[model samples]
Target: MQAEIEKLIVKFLNRTISNEEEALLEKWLANPVNEHVFHDYVQVHYAISMDCIDDLRLEQSKDRLILPEIEKVRSLDHNVKPKGFSIKPYLKYAAVLLVVGGGILLLLSKANEMENPVEVVSESEVIIAPGTDRAILTLEDGSQINLENDSIYEADGVKASRAMITYNATKGKISSEVQYNYLTIPRGGQFYVELADGTKVWLNSESQLKYPKNFILGETRKVELVYGEAYFDVSPSTEHQGSRFKVVNEDREIEVLGTKFNVKAYKDDINALTTLEEGLVRLDVDDEEFVIKPGQQVDVNKLTHEASVKYVDVASEVAWKDGVFSFKGKPLKEIMKTLSRWYDVNVVFEDKSLETVRFNGVIRKDKKLEDVLGIMKSRKINTYRIENKTIILN
Candidate 1:
């Protein structure tokens, strides 16, 4: 499967892939990490192809692609070239250059193609920075530790770095008592964690999760999404002696057999949303069970205890986990609610009718609050004002 996707990516860059093949490649790239993989491939393409290009075209392409002003990207010089460049040997590890300085060109290229790229606001103006890798780790003993950039914590068979915490695998060892730890992501914060059983989880801003420090062998691995949203990539049951995984909240529970899915159950939301990307999942809501397939979503109403399953674009549903906010005709109210949590600000809709105005686009989460609102203003969707930490929609 990976080989096929990589081949398709090569064809895509060579401008020879069919529409159907492009669709498949796009589906695979919908996940943000996969998108990073795609960029790495693009980096290799440039690295190899530039060696075969003429000096004049190479310099022109550099001028078009490089954007040094953006903090995330750096300028590329056309005159400089690696002394020894060979095709087969270099391609073997060309993709790994993304870690050093290869991906900046791809980032700038993406921004240039954006219909409404985030415009930089004035330096004198109030700047609300985007959320970062930050969270609160609550140990079983009721003690709490702040997790953020440049900070590290290691204890209780777990290790935490600047942005993520990982638990050591138990290796089939069973503990007599279960010890639970809580990870809470405050507003303007996000985090990632790997459980003892190898399941990876991404928590969004204003979310909390509770899970056992180590799962007992031959038992169902369980966790709770106390609030907000999370994306789960469960390790396959085959590797764990068929121990299934489960995620639960107050209103619903998702039974999984090693799948990748997303659940959004915010405190103020009217419904609990569960979207399955890969593998299968059984959702239990209000004592009713519904199995969902890939590209499907289940929305369980909190007020009426009703559940509905519908096919959806799995990419858009999980884009937040990839550092993007993707809206497909989503209403103003819904978009603002998401921004409110990530920006840690209050939102006021002065015009009641504006709440229902729909929008369609993708915005990177790394942009400042004003930069996001500016995109809406450019479209004549609406105007906004930031007073202190509150956003007023007019």
Candidate 2:
């Protein structure tokens, strides 16, 4: 009976199920036990289809799907018992059909009913791809080098790989003068950098970081986040002769006590946020001092300088550095702003009330813009249409 049902499911997925076969499948589905068998077959099929994907094909394929824990169990052996499956994290909207490329995935609406799946096609000719590793490196001499290509650039004590650049630590007595280098991550791009002091920094899209090529010994190691977001993992004070690290901007500065943290201080944003993941940080906003601990975030109003500290999920705060977009009770407006920065596109809300609609989920950054929009539609957040680089929501 399971084998017969599996054949029926294949026919259904291929959209070639005859009326009699469809009736038999629906009858078998009424048993409830048969549903699990159906899901297992579908999952195995999905996993097999997406196995061994190369980087180039994965990037070019618009249907780069992630089944969360399902990707781990991709075997064709029938004797292997499929573990329990729950689609809460990735697919809470289980009833929604996932239409990607030339494939249509129909999910059961209820235990007893199956809705006819329809392919949701985009009206646009071109799909907006996700961001990549790219940035502009501004040398101390004011010369800029684009880091978008696959070539390696090494010169003047600095070495740049495909997506990251590193500055070698000076061996002898350091110069009193500090030659500053700037790394600017434009829209739809991100980059990593290792400072001479061994501190690591991850610059997000539409962000910039300015740091010295070499740190003067016995002095306070300082770097400036001219504008935008950055995650810092500072080298310990003990590692650098007890020297403290400071990340500064025009209106705010973070004194790092040899720890890890993330800062969001976009130019157009009204509030500057600093979320600590590990260790401690002292923030100065408009001259008012505030000390932040791990698992806490300090939000300072850029205009009024009013500061508020609260406990938050540090993983969601710094998820971008890990190549995932994790949102927890985040408003649609704020989420759109984040997406705008990474995808390098503008979003228009026809209904302003939709901005306040909150959502909680995790999405990989590698997914295409349309896939995200489809998820938003599944959540009943809003109806959307993409026009060139702009996304219109109603």
Candidate 3:
């Protein structure tokens, strides 16, 4: 019975099966047991299709269809469906019928269409490169500092706590002789620095970092971010006193006793995002307060005062800290924004239609503007010329 079914399947797939054989095959497949066998055959046929084994003549001329060998099984005590039944015959037959039907459909659909195929080439080439020479730092003394280079400066030093240089001065107390420094990251540029208190900071482009030259012990340890993005791996105060870490962006305040987290507060973005990588954090806005745990993020809309907590992809969120641009189905505008900061170039849209395009890929920071733009073009996005360091995208 199985051999007869196989022969019928082959003939059906070749579109040469008699009406009787087609009816028999369909009837056998209508049974649940036969359907199970038919499913296995379909899997094998799918594998062959993926391999592009579509030579109909070769398949039709084949004298033998080898079935996969099954290992010996223990005896069944009850009447059960036979194991290792082959359905390859049914799938081959189905494939042939589907292909023929599809071809017919295509022919009918294109009956009124032109025969010539049109080739499209994009005409625009506007590439948004990353930015450089951006970021400003504000100091505790109400003084603002712009950091574009790797420079070590002196600050008022107090006692050391949790490997962080504790500052001795109050927020309002600025001794004429005591120097405090703030670091600012301009749009399109990022910087890394170690404060006197041993706190490591990675400032994103167009962001700012404010800390004392040296943290004064017994005084609350705080840093202010004017804009942009940053990641902090704060050190705990000695004896587990837990240093106070606060990040102020616009009207939003993120206070943490000691935790590792990332904050993105770009001016162009609608909301400020704080993702906790480890430990805990208390997010305060206006009079509302929310506690964030590890693997959670708080999104605060600076304009609407709306806040929500959500789970996020930690690796993708912190990829910028590792000097790579990783985008997962992000629109072209958002991607261009990141490139604009990294390459320090303005992005102008020449073809507004392409702005809605989304892409999924990883771009290394070391890639040149032309190389990156070429990739976009391959995806049907064109870039125009750069006008005065501005990338015109078409």
TM-score of each: 0.72, 0.71, 0.59
- Candidate-wise lDDT, in order: 0.72, 0.70, 0.57
- Alpha-carbon deviation at 168 in model 3, angstroms: 13
* lDDT: the better of candidates 2 and 3: 2
How many backbone clashes does every candidate have?
0, 0, 42
Worst 10 residues of 3 by lDDT: 103-112
Question: Which lDDT tens digits does candidate 1 get at residues 1-394?
Answer: 2535644544443344688887787678667678556655554333332322111122222233222222122133435643432122222322321211212111111222234322222222677888999999999999999998788999857899879999996597889999999999999999999999999999999999999999988789999999999999999988888999999988688999999999999999999999988899999987799999888899998899899999876766777877767666678889899999999999999987778766655566777776567535422344678789999988
Top TM-score: which candidate number? 1
- Most accurate candidate by lDDT: 1
What C-alpha lDDT does candidate 3 achieve relative to the native structure? 0.57
**Clashing residue pairs for model 2:** none
Pick by lDDT: 1 or 2, better one: 1
Model 3 residue 156 distance off true place after TM-score fit, in angstroms: 6.2
